[model samples]
Target: MESEQAERFTATLEDKLQSLLTKASTLQPEEMLIRHNGLLYPALLCPEDNLRQFAKFDARPEDMCIASYPKCGFNWVNQLFRDIAAAVRKDDGQRKIILLEFSGADTHQVINSYPSPRVYGTHCHYENLPASVIEKKTKVLVVFRNPKDNAVSYYHFCQKHPLLPNSASWDEFFKEYMAGEVAWGSYFDSALIWEKHIDDEHVMIITYEELKENLIGGVQKIAEFYGFSLSVEQIENIARKGTFQAMSDNSQETHSIFGNFFFRKGVVGDWRNLFTEEQSREMDAKFEECLAGTKLGAKLKYDLYCKT
Candidate 1:
């Protein structure tokens, strides 16, 4: 009896999913929409489908790419770059920042619209990026956060986005994350791939914890990496403008273009609030088992709380 009931439940779920897909397929490209921070965005679509004609998309040597796993410090860094570029070009009468999102339906259009010396943001794994971008040797700034905190933030983000019914529970979400079933693939794998190219002088890796600990220093490092130098006053100004309080207050409708606030409690150890001792240990063991021989194993300290 239980087996029959389970089978029926599974079939019902599959039917509902197919119905949703059919409805989505019926919509025109312009009619399909994505929501960000309570606002309807018409540009959200599948990256693979949108990027199919990838050759038309190109990058210049002056282009900048800010890459990070979701729920990391992408937006915070974006805001920081905006401030730095704005400050640098204050008297030059130039718009120093360009917003490029990888998953948007009009992403290619937006990227192609910008001139040289543009800044693009993406969550694409290294192998999946456009060939032109790699060939141009665009400056890449990659940031990473502790996976525990990333998972917690991602859980809440999924709750708002409603991508999967299974993500309603933390355990289900963690299972998908651990098994590398989520979009953008495994966090460890993505980081390691980028790490291999970091020595290229065009790529730099920044950690979220370090950014929080020293905002001014972080901004200065970013400026230096991009072949620009900011005075002490300018560094201070950028740091002040990029604060969580400032970002939270200034964000038009939301703290970020993404659904979640960019300044969502920009503090380390936030994972402690979400994971119990046993859960943390279990996650750490999983990380160790999966990434045993990888460079990411050394790059990330899964036991962040214990280390401190």
Candidate 2:
């Protein structure tokens, strides 16, 4: 079982990481900071320097990158792209999906050596992406969720993930999220930055709610984006096989560095259950202030709690 394997690796990983930490040059006893491009990121499971140098990943034009803010259905969209890659490039050898921040291989090496139509997933913002990705016109799929749901999901994710910092309460975490204190920075900032590129030929933006609302249609849109065509039956089969229920049931498919909790409650509008009325209004006001004049925010009409 994938979970059992992760359980077995837990102590080993901790031990190995502890040894590495002692030898690490930049990490401190109480705080480990990875500095890149003038930003300090905690050296959790993924190091900050590695991510900083990711600008040199040397992405190819044919490559596909699934970009998202954390906890905004990233894994879900990553899985969908993986399935699409498998179906579209069936004749080619199976391609490995690279999680840019966590992968061990040098991204440049991985991108250069991998089979055609390589897919890489990242939580990196638009400005931080490798220049080649934009220069070469690499196809990019950006999936965003309602920030209200994003914050709720991220709060729970931090609680579950072993290497992430913990939050004392939802209120505390919500404040951090709004202030852009969490990883990948503010959801509104990331959304606006990526939305600016939506008009580019290489970028396709889809909200998590849209995908959840129509999986088949989402698959079709993505397939078309990648210049691939699937039959009615094939699309139907992928949709049937790739449901949240199916992914949650299959341990290997959803295997995460932390655990399987990453797949928790893959539903839209669940933020309604988590957010207080006051908290919702606070988020709405912040969203309005931050997202003003941005197409993505305007599309949502500055709403943080509404279902689309």
Candidate 3:
């Protein structure tokens, strides 16, 4: 059975990669979309079909989803989810979780096969999500980081990971990021789409900076959102277990899915070390142009949170 499963996964991976390469071949230098099944999707690692299938997914009321732009402290927040699930749903047997865009198998098949209280993680923008996810009141947690930090992290990620296309330099990648040319598309648009639904009873928005500032409090907030009451000590334990150090210590096992070193420095404001003064101003100007006057932009607290 296991061998059959492995064979199926490998075959699916080859089929998807061939399709993507064929689609990518017809693109011009400036064109980034990988055409699949009559749909254009960002040139990301996963097969676009995964996201399309996820859109058609029928979500249950007990489903929990973690949504974020790539490299926005997703793994860290996911650890918290793991800890929370272990604490609150201990008797529910093993938890089945899916990273929607990271797998080779049929994503919809995997998800639908999972038992009740299914947990899913996705980088798909809010606009791409299934209507049932919202209409069914499935719990959704959306997290984000300052675009500058997010770009810096992603630049390094693209450089180090063999899966992604190589970036020539920070400056080159910065331009791409600023122009919203990177994989998974624009971080601004991703956040903005989800932010509009922040007030929905099924959704909660979190920031990496807020979790850094008060992990215990952040865990408490998530606990509350899940309607799971944790003791003070339980919260502290979850906070400690979910720290960057803890995650880093288990990096090899935790990040084996990505097949590379997935955890970098978990500090805020690391962008300061990379961004030149002029570049910083340029980024600020771009942020203002794209995000200013928006409620999502207003709450970003970029300067205050990142610099501190």
What are the runs in model 3 whose C-alpha is more than 4 Å off?
1-44, 91-96, 104-107, 257-260, 306-308
lDDT of 1: 0.64
lDDT of 1 by residue, 46-140 (tens): 32344454434577877767888877878788878877766665633123233343233444554465444566676765666667778878788
Residue 106, model 1: Cα distance from true site in angstroms: 5.3
Q: How high is the lDDT of residue 243 in model 1?
A: 86
Stretches of candidate 1 off by over 4 Å are 1-44, 53-56, 91-107, 162-166, 253-262, 289-308
User: Which lDDT tens digits does candidate 2 get at residues 1-308?
Assistant: 43344344444545655665455444442353354565435565457556755766778778879988898788887778877887877742234456676544444454565567788888877887878788888888888888888898999987775456667888888888888877667787788788778788888888888888899999999999989889988788778767998877763534634337777888878888879988887877877677767777765533544632
CA lDDT of each candidate? 0.64, 0.73, 0.73
**What residue pairs are clashing in model 3?**
none
**Pairs in clash, predicted candidate 1:** 43-105
Predictions: Cα RMSD each? 12.4, 5.0, 4.5
TM-score of each: 0.74, 0.84, 0.82
Residue 202 lDDT in candidate 2: 84
In Å, residue 167's CA in model 2 sits off its true spot by 0.8
